[model samples]
Target: MKVFTALEAKNRFGKVIDAAQREPVTVTRQGRPSVVIVSAEEYERRQSRAWRNLLAVMEQTGRYAAEQGLTEEALDQLLADES
Candidate 1:
């Protein structure tokens, strides 16, 4: 990853975008990490993996809830609390 200050990244926006195509670029604000710019392909890959992981977790939770005989309203409340 390449680190760039927020001002530097703004001044050299094109370079930051170009670098992101090759690998992730870290943009910082006030010396703190603010965001990471990644290529479209990498972003899509990460999004897909996250979706899959969420589904797996939901499946496991559903199994556990089933074993506990959780009612629909209780499950809905549990999910609402998580949100």
Candidate 2:
């Protein structure tokens, strides 16, 4: 990742786009990271992988709940308690 201040990124927007094509570019505001610029392909790939991981986790949790005889009401009550 390449770090660039907000002003630098704005002034060299074209270079930022070019850099993003090759890898992610980190844009910072007041020394704090604000955003990352990545190629569309990379972004989509990461999003897809994240969604798949979330689905797998949900499936595993569902199986565990089934095995433990956890009902919707019990789960709801647990969530309500947490809140």
The estimated TM-scores of all candidates read 0.73, 0.78
lDDT of each: 0.96, 0.96
Clashing pairs in 1: none
Write the residue-wise lDDT of candidate 2 on 1-83 in tens digits. Answer: 89999999999999999999999999999999999999999999999999999999999999999899999999999999998
What TM-score does candidate 2 reach? 0.78
Q: Residues 24-81, candidate 1, lDDT per residue (tens digit)?
A: 9999999999999999999999999999999999999989978999989987898999
Q: Which ten residues in a row have the lowest lDDT in candidate 2?
A: 66-75
Off by over 4 Å in 1: 71-83
